[model samples]
Target chain A: MIKNPFLRTFSLGVKSLLLHKLRSGLTTLGMLFGVASVVAMLAIGEGASKEAQDQIKQLGSNNIILRSVKPLEESNSNQSTRVSVYGLTDGDFARIVDTYPWAEDVVPVRILQQEVRFGERSLNPRVLATTAKYQSVTGRPMLEGRFLTESDEETVSNVCVLDYEIARYLFPFRSPINERIKIGADYFLVVGVMLPRVPIGEANQAAPGEEVTGEVILPASTGRKWFGDMQVKIRAGSRDMEQVDLHEIIVGVDSSENVPAAAAAAREMLDRTHRERDYEIVVPLELLLREQATKRIFKIVLASIAGISLLVGGIGIMNVMLATVTERTREIGVRRALGAKKRHIVMQFLVETIVLSVGGGVLGIALGLTIPEVVAAYTDMQPVVTPAAPILAFAISVGTGLLFGMYPAWRAANMDPVEALRHE
Target chain B: MAEEKSKAMNVSLEATAKAAADTRAVAEFRNVSRIYRMGDNEVHALDDVSCRFNAGDYWAIMGSSGSGKSTMLNLLGCIDRPTNGEYYVSGTAVSTLNDDDLSELRGRHIGFIFQSFNLIPQLNVLENILVPRFYLEDPGIGLVERARDIAERVGLGSRTDHRPRELSGGQQQRVAIARALINDPSLLLADEATGNLDTQTTEEILELFDELHSDGMTILLVTHEEEVGKRAEQVMRLKDGAIESVAYNRPTIQR
Candidate 1:
């Protein structure tokens, strides 16, 4: 019924708080830091998860990757042997593509960990030997020249497509497009350069130590003719030999919904044909779903930690308000004598606390948004700020104000007017 | 035809008003007793005390410490209720009202001037004067105008925007007086109002009170100063929670 009572009360509260500038400012810091931490933490978490999901998307949601894993028993026993016959065979790739009706395309890859040389520069890169369909299946972009063609595979051409990083490393002085690179005893022509496949830190490989820094692509028929099917690496004094027709097979489906069935059929066929468990399946769609679930839980954990700080900030407000109530006892008494009801006194104190928290909340949101930009500037992290982060933080700050201001407001309202007037 | 009927209604309304004016006092206490309990003992702060304050009358309640003078002022102001018996302000029984309704009654009918002036420290002279109206439903238009008028009347017209701390003891008491009159209260209750002021300022404040009394305001003041008491038209002295004697300083004018 009063004329602009809320506005009047709010202004009155602000006036009183302004009387003690330092105290009000210090109290505001508590909520400011609390809300800032919440928003900044969530933004950073969302950015990291987005980076991971983007990498998974690059792997093609409808594709299933089957990687050969050397069994522990075979690896331990084959250290002294001249040759170890284990892992995915050429027959397994043929069986999956021929029997599974859902499999749209199958590209078999053979990885030869070898060092390539151009003049004095040398670097060990994973050489991927696959068909022309490998480029279409993996969805990697071609930077320069043309990718491997079916004619190159049939003619068994001694040519390779270098990863962009590998190309830059080898031919820092000039273009390596038409240059010849030495792998072993033979020299291969550099036909093309493709974009670096999922930078190491961003890509989540299924097994540890499986991240490939740089790759050199060659046609499957040409690789078989030149490098043969056996790979030997000398470590310390022992030579470890592995003989496998294929290292990995990427199975593609028409849509993501068909990936699970294709993967299941492929797994079953491989299990029946291979005696030992030497292969693991990686599904991009399943990984994406799991990553989303993990991100949600991670956000909750971050919010809760931030909520605790807010609770402490709320307690700080309560503590200061209680002291203020006691300090303003005579003022309360005067208002009561002047005909103010209990609720009027409550509204006065409640308004003061809300102003404190909401003011802090606004400032906190500003600071929260700035933290992400500063992080992105200083580090290689892509911190994404969603529209909801600041809004959520601000709502919580207001809630904290109301929740914590109740008891002190009630105390101020219920004071005995006579005793309060007599209070020093 | 409507004008004639309304005139008849006004005539009857005046008759009822005159009849009610003859019997009712501004404030009355009927055998009011206020007791405070401490441990096993009962302290009768005001035991069976009865008194009446009429319109345009200035009465001073004189007593020693623990003589229940302050308690009597509080009860008459409607800030405290009696332990027994009844109190009436503007002819409405205080005992029948709830806390919120009691506050409303106090706001509309009683004006309190405390010993320390009790002007809110943070509020300016005009703000303090307008404080009572803040709690009023529909405080009405021209509230600031009326508050400024009261401030001018109290000789604070130029200092309306100055806070209480910036004012002298006499000026602070004047602000309190202006605040009390903001709502046009029927009864003014002062508890040692000039006790904190110097002799010169107290004289000035008491002159203001005399002017208010001459303007037909009912005033009750509790004080131990005989000089303060001598200025009132009637003086009532209390001894051990009961009235020992009441003396009249001036003859009542026939109404």
Candidate 2:
């Protein structure tokens, strides 16, 4: 071909790469897979962590939780008959509110898993026994009618608010408000219908949320006065009595920024008050922050793995280029004799490596974009394909090409002209 | 004759000074020595040897293998540096020129023809001819036309599209000769230009060299054959890393 003399070296670079097609292709493939995996891994990890953060945020960033676990001394499943008393006491409740002034609307709740029946329809649901402030504090808007007022708390009234799911299930055809529902021997009037909420699965419950589920909400005083804490059950020729005074206390801080401090103060107070280590502190804000930190580390680990593969690809280019320098020793000598400078020799070799790596980088980006969508389509996982991923991968590939191409190019440029000319 | 030339070095230097005054010798070696080191031993390729090549002088350097003639050819070609001493090309000291300047000097002034017809196997004849001029920015509009003209002059005008392997030894040498002449260099350095050609083609190649020499081209021919040396106006013989003799082929009758 009548190649332009200025572009002759450039064409030579391309021709050389094409000459060793298999080796070039394998090296490009190494970078291609590396970049693809990097983009895909980043997208997946970001997507997973983003979803977790969203779930935690649903519980409110300012909320803290205190869960009452059964004390080891009082509770034993191996023993047939015993009376157990543990968890948040009335005195502990008064003390927490007194110490942490930033704590706003600290709602004490007693959750009872009980079966409720109307006439013939019966279903098992959670009984959330809380105060009148639980309505505005939990932030669940009433869908119809009205929520239980302070009058319900003072009189120990037999009044309740049904969750959306239970409201629909219990009264599918007609208005269920102002109607009576029976739980065991007692009857309660349904005053309000709350909006349906996303289910709090067990994993999500690790971070706290408002005390609302597929259940009934009534005054904690009324539930305590009527049912009492001693739950006596007779089954299989044995009697089991379990008593939990207060199941959980949802403490809301005045602001999200104060959550960590409030959580620390609550923990300190609980530790000093209760010697059993029975109370576990759950601050959704703090937990979310920790999760974010972990996710950052995860991203770096993933990127590093990808970087190593690109390094391997770079080494492959270096290996092939060194062989090329040896093979073209005489050619280099001829060029030097004919007026090619050292830089010309260096440029020629560098262009070849760049061609290989850039070609691989472009292909890798295409694969990266596709893999994530394919994964999300075929599996339960959703991979967030961020724009930065492909760009970052491509940049790394080019950088890798330059980094590894240096030694071989330098060697080629520095060859002794006389000895090289004599090389067969 | 050798001792006379060596003793009265001013005689030759004066002749070069009288010829052009400002532009003296095309090439000059001032006490040049090239030593090769292999482990603890050293090989003296050229030991304190000095020579001058005046403008338009066709000189053939004849020597056997290991006589350091190839080493001399490499240094003369500006592809190798002297281990000691200075070399000047057309009054410019080569030792003072950096690598880039040396390459520029080679591009502008020196052209080479090899016995092996070392045409880049991948490039066609036309492309190979343009190799020396590649480094120039805008080698001007008539390069292709100039290349075409040179190709025709070398009798390879019809074979511009053919690769080196496709051509016979004679044709390949013509291409190398065409490449050598394309730069219109101050010196044409040929390493056994007709070594691989048949006798008939060798005579034909020598006739071309004669035509080029009479046209006022300065030529440096490094060869082994006595016949090749006989064709030149002057011959410098080397033996054991030193110059054995420098002699004129015949009395000069033409200007």
Candidate 3:
């Protein structure tokens, strides 16, 4: 032939694939789903990890937090203990703020979890008591109205701020701002609403054993006077009861860069005041790093599981291709008898495989792209899809097709003309 | 005396001219043998088969079912190589040629027509006829004109675009004949080309073959029917893979 025979034969192979469109399409479906799942799963995992990391980073990568530790022995043994202990008191906060010049800002907080009643509606809400600087230091934004001012803290005014979910739940239809809500027995006036925040860390707890909920914020001075040290009693029986104190303090550093130094300064100040080792420190930055490493391993394991499906898909392609070779034996023989070379026959089958693989790959990419969006819409867990995942999946599918298609093409090329011709 | 000598010279010149015309033999087989091994048994398909067929000659090879008529045809068409001695087609020693070289030779000089009229089912009549020309080194010749001419000669001009399945048995056979003649080959080898046709169709095909033979085209036909053998200028009968008899047509008979 004057022209390249390989090109002509390759075209013939493609033409043959086109002739059996249904068979080719069915064969490629396995590869398509295999690739799409691999890409979508990996992307979702990566996206989840990224979201967690960002939340941890926002908590201040350099910060170390120390919370109150009131031992159960002290509370149970004596109700009226002479020495007040376990948590950082107003004196300890004053000492830390005064002694350490490196300490940029020390925000001492007292937290209470209780049912606050507004009209006929009642919902359990976390109550935070801190200074005016607390909101800016921890990156909490006031959604509406104004935050607690220095005047409010100094005067111990009965002013409160509600979190977004709490406001929505308590009011339902009306605005909760400037409204009075009874906490235990005293009524406090609402000033502002806090924006919504997604919970992080173990058991969806913002802290250990604490069920995160929409919260109400009040001035520390006002909380101490009105709530009177904030104690809750869990009744074991009619006669026996256990009392717990609401003296937990969440200290906010001025900046993430100063968090570690500020935390160390506060610990040193608290150590001088308290003799017993009855406190715990938690660093979100450390937790974030460890979680990231675990996520990396998680994504790899998930991708491997998806890879098994692709391998199965490849085997499916091979099985179908072998069957096709047997089916087209007479056709092969006729071409051979008519002077077609072995390479021509081989090229023809290989082209068919490529067409199937590439077509499946394109469909798979489209499917993979929409998977994350569909998942996000239907479920609470949002899946993130990355471009690299789809590209890798497509390349791997094509490679698998080539690897599996070789054997059948070789078998077709090696068929004996006489025997093939005689095959019915 | 001079006038008598001139008459003698004219006669001798005419005889020499006839010899020169007969000397253009397109194929020759010299002591050719083909052996087929079936387990421990060896069957001789063609034992010392020797023959010479010239251009423009119409010859028939007659044999029974187990005889070596198909084997001889295969050897002449270069589809199978001979086991012993030499076989030449158009002055080329085919027994000495490799597979690729033999294919090239076959494509260039021989055209084959089987009893089944083996046309590719997917291809139309015109495409089927153009198959052999694709193997040529330079297919610069006007293929369209060549296909049209051959189609016209075989009375398949109108059915050039029709697939083999769409045409009748006689029409399919006509397409096959047109395909065989497309390359203007040195020799045409037909193995019972009209065996599947009706008597009327067979007569029509035989008449076409006769006309082609008269117009300076050589043909070698293999058939078991005596009536088919009778239409050729020369007939060779085979028995037990050996030549049994050879007959020539009478002077008044035209093939």
Candidate 4:
């Protein structure tokens, strides 16, 4: 006999459970799988949402992007004409800078699909033409040397900055600084190398064509002087001519709080001036807010699916406990006849259930943690296991055990001692 | 060593002699009646009957089936309450005590012996013997030592670690006897305690009961066999929940 009643009762419970090893093990398996799925599913969901949120954050939260789209009516009408005229002109950029007081800085951009050549290597990358303030608006950082300066833009110097991927591909063995790369018919000296940037999702693309390989930055004045605003494409049997001044304009707000208002004012100004809707506006703040809301909904859905499995596991425990109480009716009688009170019988059975569930919970947490690490190692998907995931899973497993164990314990305590002793 | 053994024996003998001189009732039942209701039909298990048991006396209650012998044993052990009247053990009325208090009283003052040697199958002999004290407070090394002493007294000292399944029917009954004596109760109640044993084993158990009776312990044995009832100092016969006759086999020493 143990001196402490608690330890004595606990040992008694363990002894009885050990008498039927296979039954107890099978019952514990239900809780094990339930908790493991909850933790693993939550981790996978959190990881996916975190990736999307990170991409949105990369785009400046206080900046709004306005892109030119060729009006469908103008393009259809110009099928027989020699040249097509549409899209944002220098006049729209000037109006936004002068009319909107919330616009802190506005940078006009032009992008041309062109191939850059270095010795025997050639790659088609987007040629971005913008001024020195583009870096400040986009928060892009340079890897080496300096960005294109004001003097470079004023003189329209034949100099360019290449993204890391482009620099590595064009100049494999040598430093890109001072190296000359040819674009179209002109050769430009490399003044700086910029770090790779996180590309925007396809929804933000202005042109529908092949994937953008990389980016090459140059001065706006240099691009206008050499290539002009008119681009002609002759494909198969048809010749298409398009004239556009600016392809994109990035507007910066005074603060994050003023971004939505600034975006609305810009839209109102464009809507009033342009007869056709030939442009699209994207607000990073709005996309971010929407993505966060979607992530919250996804978490609830995943938790509920896992919660059903836990409920099934709890039912399994209750079923086994009910059978156990019936089978041990004689033992309960003997105990009562030997002076055990009703509370003692209840505690004995409750402790047995807690032992089974808490044991399964600990094992489930281990399995849950290992699954994510294995998934991350073998696949492209990243699974993040937060500390709270395991804690919450373990807590729910224990709670399920207690909730399901109550009815059976009460039944055992309420049995008549005389009738129980007479049970076969 | 021999002198010390005789000195301890003498002290025990003197204590038994002193207890035998004091003639107080160990237990008394006054107008006790137990009724069982089966679908609006009341079955009188025990009628209005009264009895008193004094210290150092051996008694046997004999009856046929439906004679309420089982109900009487349950009531005397404090496991079941009478529907009418009151009973007292150690001068405390059983009617005033709640369920928990009755359980405590049983644990502290009464010992039970069943025909089947109702030992827990999962526990060994020593643990089974310690079951009566399992619900008591302040269990210490002294309690275990006392259990060992009683086990030796019942000639099961070598089988203390063996489960009941490994022992013979007589050995199992001996283990039950040791268990009943662990609480050192003043009243020992036995219900067909030797019914399952062979003739030889029955005589051995009866001799052990005789030894306990001579040591000034009060005992109440319920049986249907005339041979077993002849061993007690007195016998009470019950018929239809009431006493039919009271027979004295020998002159009562203390009552």
Q: Which one wins on TM-score?
A: 1
Q: Compared with the true structure, what per-residue lDDT tens digits does model 3 show for residues A1-424?
A: 2135556455555656766778888888988888878878887898788778767765555555566776555445544323334565666667666775655556777777567989897877778888887676566677788889899999999999988767877887988889999886789999998874344433233443344367788998898787666365444432222232335444555455666676666677667777775565666766786988989899888888888988888888888889889988877755554554466567678777766776777788788878888877776566777678878887887788788889998999888655665466
True contacts kept of each: 0.53, 0.51, 0.02, 0.29
B-chain TM-score of model 2: 0.89
Score residue A152 of candidate 2 by CA lDDT: 90
Q: Which pairs of residues have clashing backbones in candidate 2?
A: none
Residue A86, candidate 4: alpha-carbon lDDT: 72
Identify the runs in model 3 with alpha carbons over 4 angstroms from their true place. A1-110, A114-122, A129-162, A170-212, A217-313, A353-397, A422-424, B1-112, B118-154, B157-163, B175-192, B204-255
Per-residue CA lDDT of model 4 for A331-421, tens digit only, reads: 8876777777778889989888877777777788888888888888787677788999999988998898789988888899888877776
**lDDT at residue A190 of model 1 (Cα atoms):** 93
Colliding residue pairs in candidate 3: none
Candidate 3 lDDT at B19 equals 47
lDDT of 1 by residue, A1-424 (tens): 1258898898889989998889999899999999999889999999989998888887888899998998765334544546667888888887877787877789999998777899998878888899999888888888898899999999999999998777877887778899999987679999998974554453233243343356899999988888888898787767878898888999888888888888788788878888888888889889999999999999889989998988888898899889999999999988998899889999999999999898888899999999999998888788889999999999998999999999999999999988888899
Tens digits of per-residue lDDT for model 4, B69-140: 999888888888777766667766676677778777877778888888788777789889998787665445
- Give the Cα error of residue B39 in candidate 3, in Å: 5.9
Q: Calculate candidate 4's fnat.
A: 0.29
lDDT of 2 by residue, A112-152 (tens): 76778877767778888988767665666778988888889
Write candidate 1's Cα lDDT for B1-255 as tens digits: 432443354345544544554354888876778888899998999999988888888999999988988888888888888877667777776766778888888788888899998887767788889888888765778888898899888777689889889988999999999999999999998999999999999999999998888888889989999999999999999988899999998875444
Clashes of each: 0, 0, 0, 0
